[model samples]
Target chain A: MIERFQYDNRIVKNFLFVTIMWGVVGMLVGLTAAIQLVVPSWNFADWGSFGRLRPLHTNAVIFAFVGNAIFAGAYYSLQRLLKARMYSDMLGKIHFWGWQLIIVSAVITLPLGMTTGKEYAELEWPIDIAITLIWVVFGINMMGTIIKRRERHLYVAIWFYIATWVTVAMLHIVNSIELPISMTKSYSWYAGVQDALVQWWYGHNAVAFFLTTPFLGLMYYFLPKAANRPVYSYKLSIIHFWSLIFLYIWAGPHHLLYSALPEWAQSLGTVFSIMLIAPSWGGMLNGLLTLRGAWDRVREDPVLKFFVVAVTCYGMATLEGPLLSLKSINAIAHFTDWIIAHVHIGGIGWNGFMIFGMVYWLVPRMYGTKLHSVKLANAHFWLGTLGIILYAVPLYFAGFFQSLMWKQFTPDGFLMYPNFLGHTAGDQDGLRTARYRR
Target chain B: MDTLLEIKTAYVLRVIGGSVYLTGAFLMVYNVRKTVISGKLIANEDAEAPPLEKMDQAKESGHWHRWIERRPIQMLVISLIVVGIGGVLEIVPTFLVKTNIPTISSVKPYTPLELHGRDIYVREGCYTCHSQMVRPFRSETERYGEYAKAGEFVYDHPFQWGSKRTGPDLLRVGGKYPDSWHYYHMYDPTSMSPGSLMPPYMHMFEDLLDTTTTKRKIEAMRTMGVPYAADFPAHANDHLSAQQDKIVASLKKDGIEAQKEMEIIAVIAYLQRVGTDIKAKEVVEAKPANP
Candidate 1:
């Protein structure tokens, strides 16, 4: 018996292309939604309203853009790391096409108002089933490759990948259990408080495992390669991976704080969320320190600079996340533009920048040429940085403004801004208008 | 040598760093343009890293293998435990514990027409932005109304306990308006509340009421422990008709002629029932004073 390296780069390439395409689409949708906050007219009366388009933007970015990136990196790195070809190239293609199809269905249906009425887990049952099937296909291909690997032990990245797959599958299936009222309509099996708990549990971890962990896995792989250095601390990665996953699952309830969710769960969520800063920064530190000797390279290399900024942004977002989870802070942040600022900081600054860096590094290697224009790559970085700054700072101010106005009381004990619309119309209008122009 | 010295000088270093940063920034913008227009990568090459095996085989075996192999099962079990813990905490307190959700004697189930209206409200995803449950906090009670009690929602199959506060909570909407007022509000929200963000549901008025699903819905609710009569589906129509007459009379009082089968009437019926159940308790508590 002979071992051979027969991994399919084509699938990896397809996923990468889709990731970039959907990244742009998701970002544009996000930008549109952001603008709609300022210019409400842009939200036409029909399916394109803020309520409907908001979910579309989220689903496109998280599932279509980031999800594809996860698969792209996983397939590319997993094959070589395992020293084996994917279990089946056919399964890989099916998984790719199926995922893209699911994204397409989401794109169509969400705009058409076909939803389960759950945030993040809004896709109808048919598409939900498609997602489950495709996920299974992806899992089978992943597990088969692992089992048949020429190497015996799995690396830290593989552990993160395993956690990502298993946790996301559990999250998706559990949250999607609904009784169908129509082809595209369904009611959650667990209603009311139970439904809220289950949703944020799925929702928060969708951010955790789906968004954070897989990207952490990417960081583990790409950051080192870009810097021409080994990871600074293996022990830290171990601690970081486990603690992050376990703690991340429990922190979903923080999103529902001061609401109808039980007080104990809310407190539990807040505690774990606060604890998350340690492990999150540990991973960030590891990535940053990996470039300890390569800071000179970072000055010259566009790829390293992107990774540097991305890791720093991850650190900032992770730290801010814990702060925002606190009850007092969340009281002000929830349902405000502050939450918006926090999310985009993570999405555009951390995830977007890292993906850009990876594309810069990977595209050149894959195409067997030096970059056509380093100048262009540099330009994209600054514009993106500026866009992120322009996007987040005003929103943060707006969030505080909204929260203060909504909570403000006069000497007579009447609400300063008695109506919700008054709060929205105040500082938020300026922020929304600015975002719209962008 | 002097050129190297020039490059190493502070001004030269600053210029180099600045240009590199500028160049990197420019590349990002150009890349976006190129990506949009030609849809081409600046570079594409075959990946040169040794295939995955060489990397994997070089790692330490025993600890890593056990950790990786056990991860999936570990994550699944842990996630289940977390969910189960939260579930048990929520369910056990609500069900087994005697004092979990204090009962309010005045709280009663909705009338048949109101129940139908509540279902419509849910189907329209009103709770996506509006909450019906108010906690015993000053902010909530002041903003909405009296704090919500568990018994008020006893008959709710899936409680409309909304999460987001995109709109104000509707927990105490009962008696806030006349039957006709609700009709006009739902038809065109701006007419009732100026500067309202709520989308107009004029289509609800245009779309014929679907009574076909009423029986199945009742059956489903009954299965979910809603206290309904054994022959509730058989009497659903009679109950609906009687309730429709009352709503029509109320609407007529406000100079609005509403058909018995109109969706607006059903929605109005639901709106009127919201805080009414809790008001009954207050009336009972005040009965001693009257006597």
Candidate 2:
């Protein structure tokens, strides 16, 4: 006998609300960091300096905003795909509250200057332990739902979800190994060249698995649903998933190019990173193709507009990723505002747009009402798209302008931008102006 | 003649392997298309457990991928292995090979004061803005001094080779600026470098250097195999005091008060020490045995 159960929209609804709340907070912090960069006086508190708050901005945007977005979409879709409610509501609630508590701890501790100093992995020992525990709760809850599924075959989205959980759990555990000196402080297990290698491996993969893969899973589900079309190709998605996971791991070393990382590892990183363009673009094509017969709807619909820009930005960023990995390009671009443009393309354009679209799509349905304002939604889509273009394009130009100036030797081998005007303040003024326009 | 024949056979085998792989993939696509076309998807298909005896007798679950998908724990464990393989393969070999980190004999370990200062630097997230590793690029070397050697950072506990540089690289900043300059700059970055975006660390001035963990930190670094003096942990306070006295005198000369073992004094000692030890190689290389 088969007994039907209601899909647990309540848990999904909770995660969705918190995702929007935290996203605003995270963006506010990021805005402050940008402002602090332009107006140094904006560094108000002892802990409010760009150096300190930068990590907070990253952690908030990544773990809080994007992280909760993943949980919301995954939870909502996982039930529908598997044809079962989450295994245990109690476990789901535990996972929810535990994650928020950890975020709260990061807010208190990070500004107080208790950091591990590893980018993206900045949360200290205690918070790291809490993240591990909550992640396990999430994993168990997810697996339980999967195993007892009424569906015979798991969808491509579920596969991406599985890869996401397994890979993120592995990355988190390995990178967070540390020797503690105090309750709140610890040192990374690896040091110097080795540490840089490990941190980037974890760091780059954090961007891959956390920000990219889960959102791709969200796209796989939500795009097809919204467009009222079947996926463009299933076989292409399989190849995209497997190849991306395998190749993305080797590409981590590319971030350390021209640095102290050994030549062999660096070369391996470059080759694989170049190879990555194939699968990354294949996935992008797969996503955009899903909207094929619905092009007219894309123009009228705010949801599809967000997605159209998201997939296009994903394409732009992935192509640039390989270009940046090339040793020559990395040399010119690594420390410049060019890199800032490249990342924000993905950060704001891809992840930010996707989550915004997903949230807008979810809210009305969960509340069982029509959208309050289609005009407002369209306005948002245009403004966001324009802002990203305006913000990113100048920075790209400024990045090249800055690097060329910095490295330019006069015929006599004297520095060209010796006065520090064009390189620092002038280009940064371009960046700040772009930030304000946003 | 035999080598040429072997090479030809190898080439033939490669072609055969490629063809076989393509044939298998094509067959899989054909089979999948047929199955999907034959029936619509059953979104909530009712599944029942087969008899245990039959399941035991069936060594294989008829459909291999289906079997794995059904058992979520088994799938998760397999996924773990897949992910773990890359990290293990890359990292383990690097650790086993000591030559990966070149040795610099002149690079002495950090003093207690310098260690605390380094800790303070880590705490303040200075590495976020300023990278300590100077790359071999012409622009970087011309700007930051000597290109960083792997050996120079072997003693670095958590590696300060930061990925980004919003500010200038500080790997070789030691001795470039006077003690007073560091004092005023940390107190207020704008006061020193006009139009600089760095924040004021005046709070570090107000806070006392927390020496309570100095011994524990020295012990931790020693455990990491940094060569500290014998009885370093027990005598950490004495060593820090001696170092502090010198810094205090220097700051007094420059009129900054060096204020009762504040965090800035310790950070100053550390900044002064960055990339300075390798300069001793000239003297170490000149030494006679037992000197």
Candidate 3:
């Protein structure tokens, strides 16, 4: 017998709207931080200095902007994929409000310089506890839905979601084991080289699970829906999902190249990072190939345009990631702005464009109307594309130029451009130009 | 290329790029708002689907992947194990194996005042801009000092081998300048190095050091396996105060009147201690023979 139920578009709408709102606030902060680099005077107050603002900007964009977008897409797609409503409405509300509270606390604390000093994991001990509790609530809500799922076999998208939830929980708990000295301050339980290993293991996977995996899940669901075509291959997606997650965990040590990290671990990182391109491209190919006969629609459809570019950027950034992990190349690019350029390719290009496409596709459908203006969306696409180019290209040049200058030696064996400021000063035009286009 | 000219040109272009991106962001906000306003929200949409079947696993057979997909808990557990393997293999060795991190006999733990200074460094998020690890490269060794070693950082609670160098590496910044130089530099970076991008930390000179937690900090570090003496926490503040007084006296000798209570004194103490242990001639000579 067929059962009657209603899909929770209310929760989906709530999450999507919050995603867009936070995206603006996060990007504005990011723009401010970028500008602070060129005009040091803009870091006018202690609370707004580049050091403080940098963490705030990163956290806002990653956790607030991307984080909300993930929840929005997950809620919208998970119900349909499972053919069921969410397990509990109360749990959904708690997850939403609790997450926002965490973001708000971050906005307050980071600028005030209350941090544990770990990159991306900077929230202090109290906030860390809050995060752990909220994450468990999210887990219970998700698992409860799965147990009562109306669908017999879990779709490939749900597979990605399951992996994401499990892996992120493990990574968080292991990395956040700190010895607290006060309400606001704590030292990492692991120290020195041990600490570096754990932090990057967490850091790199945060990018993988938090940024890459959930978005891939969304891509699997939304891309097919928007294009009105089935995914290119279900088998390829299965291979892609398993290999990608397994390979990603070992690649964290690439970030610690040439540092005091053990040599064998670095080799493991290099090997696994290179192996990752296979699965990464497998997913990329699947996304792009889904649009094969739909190429004509891509030109006129702004949603398709955003998706195509998002997939292409994923391909480029994934390839660049592995290449950079190579020892010789990493030797040049590791500490340079090259790494920054590479990240933005993924950040603005892959993640940002994907979120934009998903939002445009979902908003009109949920509201029961055609888009108010497809023209405006197309314009946003062009402007966003140009902004990414202007942002990344010059930084790539600057990174290479700066690395060369740093390594340059005079005929007399003395260092050329020995003053560190000279390299940054040299890149000023590139950086300044990129800032405006952003 | 003239480096100075390029710097100025890049600065101008960055502002323009920022403007373009800002415009896109506004356009997005405008578009989404209009879409929301013109259309009514559908909070719930009607749907019908057959209830999931209760399958007989012993009788029904299919692909291997499908079995796990039907069991969410099992899938979650298997995923946990798959992802767990790498972190365990990489991290367990570094922790359990003694030789993964060698200990430098000459290296010593930070003093009470320097430890507080390090805490202040962390509190300010200085690691965002300055790196504490100097890699083994000719350019870095020439620019900063010696290459960093794992053992040198044994007492570091969380390693400050920062990823970026917006200013420069500070691993070997200790003992390179007088207490007065750090004093002025913290107050205003441009006073020491012209065209510097580092912001002036004027607030450090005014904020009082919170010495109340010095004992607790010492005790905590001991628990983390730092070799601080068992009775050290009781006298930690006295040691901190005595170090602060010496730093104040040195600042006075350089014609700068600094109070012992200021947070800058601790910062100065920490800065003066970085990389100084292994810098001694005997330590440098003793290095290769031990390991």
Candidate 4:
């Protein structure tokens, strides 16, 4: 018997709008923080200084910008893949507004100097609880839709979505175990080395499950649809999905390399991070190869162009991630501008472009019209491409220069560049050149 | 400080780059807006699909993987287990096992004043720019003193071994400067380190230390295995005020007037205490270095 239903495009639209809005806001904050590094006066008092605003910028970009994009792309794709409306419209509305509220709370509290002091997981106890609650709402809504899916076989994309949902939930609950001293203040349950391990475990997986996985899910869906092709290889998708999640969890310790984390755990992180290249590239290749015979279309269609660049960036960033995890490279690269450059490649080139591509593809179909202008989109593609190069390239050079200068010594066994500011000053020219080009 | 002038060109470029990115974002917004205006939203689109049929367990003789994929609950559980293995193996041993983080007997808990000051550090998000962990490299040791030990941070509730080093490592910053220097530096960074990018934390001088939470904080620390005496929370404030008074008197000796209750005094206490543990000869005889 045939079943007739409507796919909810309203929730997708709302999420997409939030994604674009937050993208602008988050990037603006990032640019401000960047400038604050060069001009200290821009840091206005305790409320608007680099110290507080940096977390605001990071949280906004990762959780607000990319996070909403994930939901927007996932909701649209998940519904179609499942062949069902969302299980509950109320739940969808609640999830959407609840997430926005959490972002708002972060904006208000983080700048006010209310924080738990964890790097990525910096939200105080109340906000953490709010995130957990909203996350559970999202999880229930997703699992409900999956259980009620009209399609018999779960798509590869759905599998990514499931892993993202479950893994993020687990990571959040485990890392957010803080004993609260007040409503807004709390101490981490894990102390010292144990705390470091736990925080990074959550931090690394936040990248893996939150940033990488869901975007991959979107790519798997949107890339194929835009190119009008099936995935390049079904078996490869299976291999890619499973191995990526399994390997990514152990790679957290690489963040603590050369720090006081246990040697065995550090080795585990390094070994697994190196091992992650296979599945990561597998997914990248699969996305790019989906457009194999459609090279002309890719050149003509701006959406496919965005996707092509995004997937290529994914490959480059993934390769770099593993290389940086190596002990020798990590010695120079860790805590330098190189790490910053590495993330932006994934952030702007991979995740940002993917969001652009997905949005361009979705808006037209959902609104029952052709795109506003292919030329403008192509222009965005170039400008954004230029922006990323301008942003990442100089920082990469700056990283090398900074690390070398920090390690340099005079022949008489004295520090060559004794002042830390000298190294920072060395990179300013390169950074200026890069940002100026953007 | 001469290099500070060179940073101006980079600042201009950052502005330009940011504007260019912003311009692209504006283009996207316009493009999306035009698309939205030209077309109507389909709040819901009609779709048709065959109803999912309940599969028979006996008849399901295909690949083993297909069985799990069809069941979302089972798949979620399995994924949790697979990911859990890594975190559990890495974290549980460090917590439960003794040798993972060997104790340094000289390492002791922060005094009530220093603990409050540490809270101020956390509050300001100083860890964003400065790292507390110094890797055991020749250059790092030469520049930042001794390499960091895991045992040194046992009392740190949320370890601030930060990832990035936008500023120099602060692990061994203790005893490196006078209290007046820290006071002036926190009041205005450029006064001490010329061309420093660090923001002036003038509010620390104006704000009084909120010792209201001292008891609760001490209790929380004790709960988290900090090894504070069971009776410590009851007298924590007395210890805090005593330390605060000493810091205030020392700052006065340096020709700087400061109140005993000022947040800067507490911050001074914390900074003077940081990374000074290993230098002590005996645990019972540990004393904070004078500025």
What residue pairs clash in candidate 4, if any at all?
Answer: A432-B10
Best-to-worst order by lDDT is 4, 3, 2, 1
Candidates in descending DockQ order: 4, 3, 2, 1
* Candidate 1 local lDDT, B155-206, one digit each (tens): 6545666655556778888886667777877776656555455667766577
Encode model 4's per-residue lDDT on B142-219: one tens digit a residue.
Answer: 888889888999999888888888778999989877787788889987666666788999899899999999999999
TM-score of each: 0.84, 0.88, 0.95, 0.95
Across A7-26, the per-residue lDDT of candidate 2 in tens digits comes to 77778877876786787677
State the DockQ of every prediction: 0.13, 0.14, 0.51, 0.53
Q: Which structure among the candidates has the greatest lDDT?
A: 4
Model 2, position A27: C-alpha lDDT score = 68
Chain A superposition TM-score per model: 0.94, 0.95, 0.96, 0.96
Q: How many residue pairs collide in each prediction?
A: 35, 1, 24, 1
Show where candidate 4 strays beyond 4 Å.
A423-438, B1-15, B57-64, B282-291
Chain A TM-score of candidate 4 vs. true chain A: 0.96
Give a tens-digit lDDT track for model 1, residues A1-438.
453344566787788878888976776676565445434456665577666777888899889988998998898788767777788989998999999999999999987777776777879889999999999999899988887676655667777787788878888998888777568766567655556677778888888888899999888888888888999988888788777876787788887787656677788889989999999999999999999878999988888888898999899999999998988888777766577678878887788788889877766555445666777676667766776676667667766765666676667776555545563323332233224324
Candidate 1 ranges with C-alpha deviation above 4 Å: A423-438, B1-136, B148-166, B234-249, B257-267, B271-276
In model 3, the Cα lDDT at residue A363 comes to 92
Give the per-residue lDDT of model 4 (tens digit) for A22-139.
9999999988998888778899778999989999999999999999999899889989999988889999999999999999999999999999899879999998989999999998
Task: Score chain A of model 2 by TM-score against the reference chain A.
Answer: 0.95
RMSD in Å for model 1: 9.3
Model 1: lDDT of residue A339: 75
